[model samples]
Target chain A: MEGMAIRLQGLRKSFGETTAVAGVDLEIRDGEFFSMLGPSGSGKTTVLRMIAGFEAPSGGRIELAGQEVTGLAPFERDVHTVFQDYALFPHMTVEQNVAYGLKVRKVPKAERLVRARKALAEVRLEGFGKRRPSQLSGGQRQRVALARALVGRPRVLLLDEPLGALDLKLREQMQVELKALQREVGITFVFVTHDQEEALTMSDRIAVFHQGRIEQVGTPAEVYERPATPFVASFVGTSNLLEGESAHRIVGTPGTYSIRPEKIRVLKESAEADQPEHATAVGTVAEVVYLGDATRFLVDLDAGGRLTALQQNLETSSEDVAAYRGTRVRLQWHRRHAVAVPVPD
Target chain B: MALITRTAGALHRRPRLRLTLLLTAPLLWLAVLYLGSLSVLFVSAFWTTNSFTSEVVKVWSTDNFHELFTVPVFRQVILRSIGVALAVTALCAVIAFPLAFYTARVAKPKWRPLLVVAILTPLWASYLVKVYAWRLILSEGGLADWMLKPFGLGGPGYGLTAAVLTLTYLWLPYMILPIHTALEQLPANLLDASADLGAKGWRTFRSVVLPMVLPSVAAGSVFTFSLSLGDYITVQIVGGKTQLIGNLVYSNIELNLPMAAALGTVPVVVIVLYLLAMRRTGALSSL
Candidate 1:
């Protein structure tokens, strides 16, 4: 990218015995909404805290707009953070909270107040400056926390699970609002989250972390469709994972594979000779789930665990399913959709 | 809102029979043991003493109160006692603050209880024994003199300094525990958030720790003031004529009970004013 907002090289951090971030390296483009997604203990939050300067990297260099910020104090860094708890000073009013950094930077009082009012309006919290954090609801407090971080006009914004504390509906609302916020501001953003859906909905790109390493970095669809490891594939969405024996080798690669349950199709009766070719697995119908638009079924595989198959409820009768439960059946999926991922040792 | 408060209030308003039963024991004790005793003192304070007979007469007089002020020693004693108590409170605050801060904020979890036990072990011992032990060290022909004999000085260190020092030692832990409790309960994240915001070290201490612990300071002051004010034994044992109000009250009551009653009113009034000021500030209610 022509203007790199933040470039981290070999960022490593450890707490006494536990190494949290181990040599993470990346460059976030200017005006990009970059997200770090991972399970707990995967060091995504540690990376965000390192960028925010709440934590110092044991071995690495962090650059923002071509200037080094690794040794900078949290306030000294040209980055602001929205914490998961929204860490608003309960004693201060909304306006005072937003004006804190500006006042510390010695922005003149008149100018600071104007900037604070504008920031409050940015988060749609205008006329709420007099209220304390305790006086506000969860959503309003989150907006106040955002305004406090944003009024400083830092080069980069770091959001650490900022919507995690909200309920489901509010989380969806804030995700859309945050996406619009990022588009309007055009500042580089480094968002950290454990929720795969939030990361997919908001990010321009996501770095999926496992243990202390990035397993893959790509757009949401790319990572979902072509997950490089079993962890990423299983973590991203629902799947009917399968283990298969090798056919005659073409390129001699290992042959373990997985397919989405939705890809499996059910046929009413046994077809004789000419059926569209796909690999087939036979099992007995173990269970069925009738979701509104689709019906899902579990097929007890001969090997062990059940294979899930999701079928559309295109017909009202489900006459085909009348014979499904406890009935022997064959399932098939297109060979191409069966993705290959590295199996762990 | 008013209706909800009334409904809640109804539940709490004491039932007439239960209230009367609960009030009976305390009311009886107060009416007889307290009020009855105070009535005798009040009457005795005004009773005239026959000049030659050395017997108290039932006739009313202001002579006891008159004698209290007419004597220079009693007035000096009153002022000295206040000075000693105030000094002890100030000393306790200074010594207790760092210990309380360390216990509440800095010490690790395992070591914290150990430090608390170490600080409180002195309190577990008998108060009389502790004061008596100090008496031996401060006396002229005691271990303090024995220890100083090598340097050719044998002197009585037992005076006003000894009394003040011993009183502070005894009550210092009392002052510390309440302050420690208050400081411990203060929202710890508030301090962490302050530091993360840009304030470091002492700035965080001044803005967050101090304001939140003001109630504790008020609590500690209450203990130190009330305790040292009522304590005449330490002064009499080690004071060696370094007069205090407590010692003055002791001698006046011993010499003439009516005179002592007149003298005792000073501390009672001071304590009442202290409580009133604390209440007005909402300091006591905050607890």
Candidate 2:
């Protein structure tokens, strides 16, 4: 069995009257890329900070590598964090910044410099060590921050939205690079991010957080396919929620159900949906949004609700899909695609 | 009114003319009133004083500078002034760093501006009044002695130590302002990142906090050092027989104007050299 890298029991933090992380219990396996995915103010960052020992949990026990580390300072713990802003020391050269951890640990100067350079090379930043952080571009600075955190080789690396500042293209590129680096290093990576796509693409397992509590903990595919709660269904991706009359009329149920937009296919009103395992609804296409690679059709069903269906733009252009608005259409998906999610209080 | 409108239109059309007009007054003030007098001082420093009738003499000579360098009393006073300036700057830094850190980083945001105003309140008081207050405090059996009596200790009576103490108090606001600004602007995440990198509090302070705020410290020291170097009134009031370069310059103004100007150039030269050293540390860019 894989060892647990980090474990938290009843982790809670409150700033005065407002609670940031109400209660969290999690066990992150060693060498796994675990993510806490949530929207801003959902307490994901507070949880990450508490695990890193930058913040003291108001009521909880934190264990790192099976040793209780509750109330220990960040320096005393066996973890490191990559700040969102990069937080590269402006005064030091890139090498010195990466070597800071080793220097603090009383590592020999020559050995630390060698390890710093090796870490930099791992991030593809060789020979850039003499440059100051201000001299490097945004993406380069990000790699330097990554290298600096990795050079210490801590048991668990806590990253707090480290790519939040980068542009879309750079963020996508670094996401891949970070995933590969985590796999190569074989250290537990606990990534906290509000970007659902980032968490979905990089994390081995994800814990969806809402209002300071985990909504669900599962693999990315599981979280995406079978969301545990209504919040998770909407937050992780676009979900066409059906409830009450619509749920009864279309889904043949009287509870909340989440259907992924991509699962439903839009067809002409007269198109046959004869399969017994498929759920079909007749609706009018109220709006059509052209998304380059895909087209989103917002359908106002006659059954008393709106459903969104995504269709690939393989044989259609923007003008062609734009002409689909206000047309009568039929949306069909497999019956099992509509997952019943627990309604929130 | 038409002429005014035409002139404004013309100025708007020509950016260079507009900029020149905007800068003319300040440029004139800086060049003529400031640099003009400074050049006059430099030229007069090389001239000598007539000894026979004690009349004005503008003949160019290095006699004053020669005496300023050779004379034992002038050398002693010059060294003493520099020593006091350095001591005051060091003490101001040691005292102001924690106070400024508290005001900027530790204090609640609502109280920051009020704390800054409190630090600046002393500057509104008359300089002579402040010096005289220090004079009273440093007097035998005064506030200093009264405060130290419980510890079985007494104050260092009026002298160079008194001058350094008074100057440190006087120039503390100058030191605190820049350091406070720098500390306020320092990102909190850097501290967190430092700690996350396995640096303890003092290590983070030395590696992250100190280097980042050093330029501001140098900026503040400029104020404290130069001001302390040129101060003579505080010495006269509370310094108790201490003679600084400013005292020599003030005493020689009537009898030996050239000698006084030469004496004045010493602090200016020292300040220039100090600025060059600070610039090497990249302090000027932050300033």
Candidate 3:
């Protein structure tokens, strides 16, 4: 936990005509829960594989705990991967699967059994050791996979969409459990996922990727609130992008500007007579959507554009939410909340 | 046409009816033709033969069984047949594992199918032709002798060794195909997971690949063992004076059909017992 656990410089991979990971440079801190988030075919998984030494990078160097491990075999590297499919050996019992790494290291039989049981217990699976992997539930099998990887005590753990196969409720529950487990183990956990919400909830820092390149890397709040590019803003969360004349009229900016829906305020004409001090636009309400905990209003601005504003329910009834439709309301926000992002071609 | 279509639709609606229809032909053939003939063979084994006229007497007697158990030549031939079958199976497995692994896992994707075709190409030649070719290869001053001459050694001439070698070569595809299929069906990520768990290549092969493929290996051995046990032609072509149960059965078939029937039961019994023993080891479940 004292130095960088994983580092990649100029990592590139290509399969015939298509490039998967194109020149990725990254450093993961010791014991940090870092997430690589992207859509499918965005090369996030390839980058994770390169770090785990499963795929030799077409060009680059990978350093694990200050030692260069490029071109090394997966077992030779001080890293482990929790594959998306779990990949539990169907023929092996849970205890044997968990003890596999120990056995490979040539540990004594008694110690291997004891450590495997302890690792299984750490995953909250205590008496299910003798059962085969096919006999376990998907969630239980996932935990077995985690135990199998964790029992090896590698310097870093690389997960490639480890919970992508689980149902929503189980995935959410495992997300919390995985974050807690990483905290307990104090191992650098490099998690790869395409689900933005999953990355947001579990990661200490996240790298958002697009089309084989890292678009932005930051803390969750920073990436969500101040996205560095148009792709990050659109991919991370719901953002209303305003560019060209609209951005100039609103923020006096030439570049594209992104505003989160929740940051804009919908003001009624009879409310306190207060006005926005930074930026304001008057528009007629085009659509009003009533969520249980929040209300959304789509405003058609006088400048011939649409903007979305979200407001918390805040003791308001559904009737009030319905009344906002088709009425002219002022969409207001502070200038600081309007983040400028690079416009895509 | 409408009636036929309606009938087809009705049958499709009932899965059990469709399954019964699908299975009827094979079931009837197996029950009436194959098993019926086998039962006739088994019954013939119990009949007595008149030594004076060589006529078969349909009497229920254990005389044939007694000779099968008590005769020294019968016992020697039975044991030798089993030993040759077992040896051929073991040798085929030892050779097939590496070849199948290379074809299924190590060879490049483009080369895999080519390798499989290469392994199967030998099987396309007629069985008789292959055995005859091996006969030449094992004969004096043949290809095997010429190759071994550099080391100052000669070929193992026509005998049990030659029969074993020829049979192993002939039945190798049977072993390689099933094991290759098993290895191919294995999930690619499983190997990666083992390596990720810090298991080296050899350990992964021992712990994961070997166990998963055991069933397929057992399935392959069934082919090799049973086929080797029943083979008489290969031995006739390659075996000089050595006698197996198959050769004994062949020699007795025309003059003493009952004795040949009894001798034929040896391989059937041995194969059944072998299958049962393999089942005890959980090989059937894997298959």
Candidate 4:
């Protein structure tokens, strides 16, 4: 249907003997912000390249707006990509870089220039059009790259770690701006990033990739709270994974379970499980990590495994938490917060 | 030994003295020997040769330059030499761009060093040997004519064309190396970004690849143009009757030393002008 912007069925890619993307099936909805979150060598970028028609799938069908486009060249595909390196032409001015796609599409020079100016304004780079890409700062060049890709108004915009090069402060700022820009353009955005926080902050739905396959596809909350596999449990965020004897003793089940560190509460040694739905474990504090806004407590559980608990620094300073090291404490969480995950082969 | 150590300590403390000491020998060579001969040649261009006695007289005159600009044979040779240089440069560029692109981008990574070595192998042979080899190829019933005989066409025998061809062959490695380096340094992501933005292969090449490599091409052209402009031996070996500025200078060197120096200045002046033009294209900075 028209509601589906992109569809990949049994898509696969291999380089010589190495399989980069084994098999992937995905459908990105129209006007949705979708993210493929994975580590390096996990094949997330390869799939994005396939959708952009830069790499042909070894065995798959790629349909864009319900039309089969697996055999098309990159120029023939109605998609644009913002590269991680921000590959703006160094020879051209910012205006020329932004107007390049329109020029390729045979848009008249006058009209393309006006559209380029508008795109630059959208990225808040109105007066910087005449400057060369080399003259701009890293963040400004990033904005120019965005303006260049969006000037054509393609059906789907694929961004491959476009913000990965920036410093953390600028990256966070651009993340907010990019999300706002995606909403305003109402275009399908397939973002690929290794940073889970970036994916969670921007994507309406996230597909977590591991090895060469999709581990889970769901909303950020679902993937973080209820991971489908043990790999997804540890990758999406920090997780307290209990398995085998530890799982049976603490969770009352003989299987793997993932409980988020933020979900577990570090309490006084004499604390009791006040609610019937609470799961409690007693442990000695092994390590105390003082993050600025929150303190992390790593407890060596008597039940045979270690569990990490993140407590907000409300009334405690670094010295106060540092003194908690080697002290006895109780870790408690709602039983529902711990979800069962499948064991990896 | 104490004096040597004290001098060393003094040199280390004085950076300016150290830099001056480091540059003294090279500066002496460049200024006294290299530029010294060039200035002497320019100064002698103004002196005249005795017509009857055939002896050098230290009398300054503009007659050599006057004859250089006004004589029909001299003007024709100047123009023809410039034309041949331009033609050779153009042909080298036409051949080198694709060859360099393939060697730099399209070839397998393992083959790249081998291919570069192959290009450089031609340069290791003596220049005269290469030109003489071309001489045999362009001679009557040689390889070129023998190959073209099946097509009922004759080879371009020893002439301006033969001279240009030999010069292009001689200077091609120079052109290929710089452009190859530029292309190799070009990031692969720019090409992908171009295609991803809807530009096809040729369009990407024209708008992205060519502009970025123009400085390198200009750098290569400097070698090709100057080398072709001043060549006399290749023309003599394979040029048949073609007379370039080098031949004119060589012939006039003994009998008409002033005229020979004047004619030599023509190539130097042309090269200087060519360098100015290339500098406008931002080539010298890249070089």
Give the poorly placed runs of model 2, Cα more than 4 Å off.
B1-6
User: For candidate 3, lDDT tens digit of each residue in B1-287?
Assistant: 99999998999899999999999999999999999988898999999778887889898988888998899999888999999999999999999999998899889989999999999999899999999999999999999999999999999999999999999999999999989999999998998988888878888888888888998899889999999999999999999898999899889877778898999888899999999988865767756
Model 3 earns a TM-score of 0.94
Candidates in order, TM-scores: namely 0.78, 0.97, 0.94, 0.98
Query: Worst 10-residue stretch by lDDT in candidate 3 chain A?
Result: A268-277
Q: Candidate 4 clashing pairs?
A: none
Q: Candidate 4, residues A124-210: lDDT per residue as tens digits?
A: 998998999999999999999999999999999999999999999999999999999999999999999999999999999999999
Compared with the true structure, what per-residue lDDT tens digits does model 1 show for residues B64-176? 77876778877777777778888999999889999998997789877888888888999999988999998988877888789989999875587888899899998999888
- DockQ head-to-head 1 vs 3, winner: 3
* Tens digit of per-residue lDDT, candidate 2, span A19-133: 9998999999999999999999999999999888878899989999999999899999989888888999999999999999999999999999999999999999999999999
Q: What's model 2's TM-score?
A: 0.97
Q: Can you give the lDDT of residue B91 in candidate 2?
A: 100
What's the lDDT for residue A128 in model 2? 100
Name the docking class for model 1: incorrect
- The candidates' DockQ values read 0.22, 0.90, 0.80, 0.92
What is the C-alpha local distance difference test score of candidate 2?
0.93
**Cα misplacement distance, residue B284 of candidate 3 (Å):** 3.7
